[model samples]
Target: SQQGEEDPQALSIQEGENATMNCSYKTSINNLQWYRQNSGRGLVHLILIRSNEREKHSGRLRVTLDTSKKSSSLLITASRAADTASYFCATVTSRLDSGAGSYQLTFGKGTKLSVIP
Candidate 1:
């Protein structure tokens, strides 16, 4: 099942400002992950906080999880032009039969964030 659908299809902000995005999911998950996808580029992992974890942060990114409601939020502090990208939240899950590092990550459509210089 799909997880983490963000509100607001797009958002625009000036460089140095902060950006916020919210995501809501529909199922029980092992972990929730956030990623950034630049225009015409691959998605990069920003942070992954397990269902057991309520909050996590990395550099300028802050994320919070509320399993009770199956929702999460992302905040980017002091946004940069470099931060202009589509931010996605995904579900990181594991199946006992897999031989990989242990999880398959599925991403949502994402919130397109534009930061102007």
Candidate 2:
């Protein structure tokens, strides 16, 4: 599957600590997206980094992508208990056979993070 696999299926850390998660994909992609999902809530888009971009930052979150290695990493600094959630990495690949602007998005099983205050 072109979907990425997240490392350390589960993680636990204290508040104010930094949390890092890694993802590896099997094929080429147009972009990679990170999403956060609370226990019973829907996913919320965290960030999106294009294949042409190597790194990006949003508030306390930082993401890095290594196209050559087909991998990516997400880091959350000064994590809080509210940061606890399931994090997923989704990869977008263009569909060559499909008409213009067609693409497919694949998501990983996700990494569950728990932050203790």
Each model's TM-score? Answer: 0.89, 0.95
Tell me the TM-score of model 2: 0.95
- Clash totals for all models, in order? 0, 0
State the displacement of the C-alpha of residue 5, model 2, in Å, after optimal TM-score superposition: 0.3
Off by over 4 Å in 1: 95-102
Q: Poorest 10 consecutive residues of model 2 by lDDT? A: 93-102
lDDT by residue for model 1 over 51-100, one digit each (tens)? 99998888889999999998999999999998999999998767558776
Off by over 4 Å in 2: 97-101
In the range 1-117, model 2's lDDT, one tens digit per residue, is 648999989999999999999999999999999999999899999999999999999999999999999999999999999999999999999877887869998999899999999
